[model samples]
Target chain A: MGTPLPRDPIADAQRNWERHGWGDVAAPMAAITAIMRTQQILLARIETVLKPFGLTFARYELLALLSFARSGALPMNKASALLQVHPTSVTNAVDRLEKAGLVARSPHPTDGRTTLIELTAEGRTLAKKATAALNSEVFGNSGFGADDVDHLIRVLGTFRRDAGDFTEE
Target chain B: MGTPLPRDPIADAQRNWERHGWGDVAAPMAAITAIMRTQQILLARIETVLKPFGLTFARYELLALLSFARSGALPMNKASALLQVHPTSVTNAVDRLEKAGLVARSPHPTDGRTTLIELTAEGRTLAKKATAALNSEVFGNSGFGADDVDHLIRVLGTFRRDAGDFTEE
Candidate 1:
């Protein structure tokens, strides 16, 4: 949004926090802010790669998840749980995907109370193409070094589990 | 958003990537996905603490930045640069803050064309209250332990630098 500053703003904020006598929480504050900023950067990169496919990260994620599912389908709640997002969000994404003819909602045959979100043939194709683009353009050249990627996966894995995102198998 | 899954969805996504022969990019994919998820969790926590103060994270950041300035005011461009957000976003935040009587805008004293965003008395008090609450509720009990926090700060500092967010001083 502007020219790079000579120093990191988050680090400066950490110093300010310490100077204000909130030293105990300063580090975590900086860490959290950094995560926020980093996510912004990475999401920009990801959305750029996905844009040609007309997918936002959230929608791309749903398509990718469905493409990987056993029958190219998941119950709406199941998709929401696996994505760690609200069910309403899944419903919104499905609505958009359905409108675009990428996916369809159907009554679960045996479990009449449940709805299944199934990828359309077009959805499966788009998912594969969008994924290849992300793999090549974003993930393959993700800013972190290999070791840093490993460290982040481990550290944030613990953080997510602690946040009750999931339990170990 | 639902019951915690039996396994981390990100790790499962990594397996899916690998199975699809995206082996080289899988780790970074998982890492990036984890960061996205972590940001969501942390933002939810931060916003919960901020809501009572009538601030979202973006507004709180601007107010907090103004509160830290030498005279509780900064040129609009300066605030935008420091916040690493688009100037348009700064304009929007300033618009809301001014409407709420939390901040005011004035022509820059020395620069005829520049605008300054200054925290009002109410803004300063609100900022302090918000910071204290965040320090207590979110930062103090941040899910990451001290070591993880340190690691995150370092790793993300490097990532930010690599992304051209800033240069080391």
Candidate 2:
């Protein structure tokens, strides 16, 4: 529906690799490039979707995580681990969410050295609305149908597992 | 070999989604999250490989691009387009590469407004060696064998095309 992509640089790179007698090495190069480029494009689309909600994907993820919690709260360290980002990034996202009145930080009830993050009522409401919007507008419409999406997840899961992203359970 | 990935947060997110009556939306969320996390892992691996060469993936890409050029030179605009990065990113990368003495800029022979970036002899030599190193280490040794690598590129290519990353050729 949008303007078609202008060119395929990965394919061009592959051709160049072949011409240079490096044909065997071309696939990985193109694959990595495509993965990187796709991340960029997806991030941009996500940013555009989240802009109206006054949230970035990082903050949105934090809010969503809290909303999903049984107590609507999580320790900062737990949040960091769950989000698969560094503590500093978690701290930064929490700071932004707090400033936006979507999240609050409190001392963990039992842990002397831990801080817990909770979603405010406003945050909960926003998270719900934002999730719905994203589901319909971005995630649900990601172009790949259910079958392709499943295949992508399966293959990428293997790639991630091999990269030590997570132990296969 | 490295510390195994502890757990897949994306999978947890999917379970949450299913429990929250958003089951249908789980696939895209997991897929995008996997893509993003995989990119992070790949970048980390790439960074490790490039560190010895005093290069980051961004700088390596610029050098590799110039190395692929017939004249070992290309305009900044062209580099930006080919790399699928912004002009400022190109400028920053070029600035760093120039300071590293791996790249040099010269005025375009006929176009006053265009500047050509060329790999110095040192740059060219390093590019060659680095390419070889990456081929044997990170890129070539990426867990996916040739078949899986090709399959990844094909599927991701379709995804990117649908995302409007490039016009179908």
Candidate 3:
């Protein structure tokens, strides 16, 4: 804890240079690299638009997921896993979602460290509106059909599948 | 900065909540919802593995782009535009890359605000190896293939285009 991060150039550089080789660094950085950069640019562009709806992307996601969920809900752990974050983060997100009245948390009834989250009535109404709005923005009027989407999901799933966690080979 | 950020409750919660909802928070944060979330998670994982390399995703990206360029170089502003980062951020990234001996800079013949970047021999050599390794990790016999990748990219592009970024849509 003394050092927030390593400082030994001689010692740490080798360790830091672990697997992210020159080859990977040289590639399209987009095709195989992370999507955060592209998204960050877009996110900033979209913020002003979302302002009128009183929704942040996260809240919208919570509402969207809950609305799409089979039971209109999910356990805390499931949500966390689905969202790809640590359990603690899910706990915090759910807590906020609860406060916003977009979602509610209940005892797991199964696991102690787990909680169940479901959308509130208000949450559902807002989520639907948001989803529709989101859908429109993503596709525009070109009207690329469901088949295109299915194919895309399939391919991307592969991209993600092969990529794994981005750390392990 | 007038304010580190605005006192927007909705925006704040969205930013925090996104740590979970978007599926991964491993990348740097940005206001764009989909792009940022995707970037954060993928970058997070890649960077985690890359920590041993003493490189941030930023530095890695610089290497990758230069390696991919036919001339083994690009202008600072071109790089910034391509990466969706500010010109200053591009300058900072280049400084780090130059120090690492992975890339070099030359004054632009055309633009004063621009600097040309080229990968070093060592940097070029290293980048090739890293990309192969990363390709293996992402699609590495993952039971997903080119068809899958094609489908996925199309879908994601569609989604991003349709969604118009995370913040507004």
Candidate 4:
């Protein structure tokens, strides 16, 4: 790398907060800021790995979602809901994926007004290869050991639960 | 809210991965995806709290940074570096903050080619008030107990450190 990425800025900010007599707020600020920066770093890394496959993380997610569908296809509306994204985003992803010859759109078999997204043979093959690449390069070695990974999920899960992401038993 | 935000989609996706015989990747994917979604949720919450102050989270961050400066001013390049963002983003943030009367720009006192960003009196006042609002409304109630917050920071810190966010001690 030309220049190494600098040390965490939030750490410096936290010190600054303490100096300014705002130590009470520093912990939460540092936590949130780190989460945001970590997201950026992870996305950048994933995108880099997907670049050679002509996929951004978003596109890769769409392909992977399609690949996971039991019928190898899903209604656009269902895709939108399942992906937890807006309808326009799903539509846009499909448009680009279709242009890339990785997926196709057709009228839903049982619903006249519904559109269905189905993967092409090329799309299926690409999805598998991309998955393998991501597994080895990004997912498999995200720098967190298995215990750390489990802890992260549990910690973040608490926030998600409180935000109404799901009701706890 | 008309309907509470639905359960975290990533959790559902993780389950789908297991059902599809990709359980091996589910743990890492869940951890990463939950982190990504949590970032979005936190940003949205922060933005909402900052809305009444006529600030987005990015603008609020700039104000807070200036407020924390020992000299109450910083060079633009320094702001970019400390903020861990591109120079163009610093320029953009300063431009918006200036337009909002929260900050002012001037030539550096001793450096001919450097520009300095200083918080206006109004900016200082707003920064404090905004900090208070965020502290009580958003940051203070981020859904993580103190222990969980500490745990999240430690776990995410590991990833950040390994990703070259900072050098190890």
How many residue pairs clash in all the candidates, one count each?
A: 0, 2, 47, 1
Report the C-alpha lDDT of model 1 over A31-140, residue by residue, as the tens digit: 99999999999999999999888999999999999998998789999999999888899999999999999999999999988999999999999998999999999999
Query: Which docking class does model 3 fall in?
Result: incorrect
Those runs of model 4 whose alpha carbons end farther than 4 Å from true positions after fitting are A1-7, A18-22, A109-113, B1-8, B15-24
Q: Give per-residue CA lDDT, model 4, range A59-149, as digits (tens).
A: 8889998998889999988777666667898889999999999999999878899999999999999999998888778877788888988
Question: Could you tell me every candidate's TM-score relative to the true structure?
Answer: 0.96, 0.93, 0.56, 0.89
Q: What TM-score does chain B get in every candidate?
A: 0.96, 0.93, 0.64, 0.90
Model 3, position B37, has a per-residue lDDT of 37
Give a tens-digit lDDT track for model 2, residues A1-169: 2344467878988898888878877788889888898888888888889899998999998999999899878999888877778899999999999998999999988889999999999999999998998988878888777876787788788887776657855
Chain A only: list TM-scores of all candidates. Answer: 0.96, 0.92, 0.66, 0.90
Query: Which predicted model would earn the best lDDT?
Result: 1
Off by over 4 Å in 3: A1-51, A68-74, A88-92, A95-112, A115-122, A139-143, A156-169, B1-51, B56-58, B68-73, B84-92, B95-101, B104-110, B118-122, B135-143, B147-169
Rank by TM-score (best first):
1, 2, 4, 3
- Model 4: iRMSD? 2.7
Which DockQ values do the candidates obtain, in the order shown? Answer: 0.84, 0.58, 0.08, 0.53
TM-score of chain A of 4: 0.90
Question: What is candidate 4's lDDT per residue for B37-95, written digit by digit as tens?
Answer: 78888988999999999998888888988988889999988777666667898889889
Q: Compared with the true structure, what per-residue lDDT tens digits does model 3 show for residues B1-169?
A: 0111123222333444354354232111222332343455466666765666667778776776676566778988767655546778888988987888988899888778767999889888777666555555532433334454344444444444444322221
Top-down lDDT ranking: 1, 2, 4, 3
Least lDDT summed over 10 consecutive residues: which range in candidate 4 chain B? B1-10
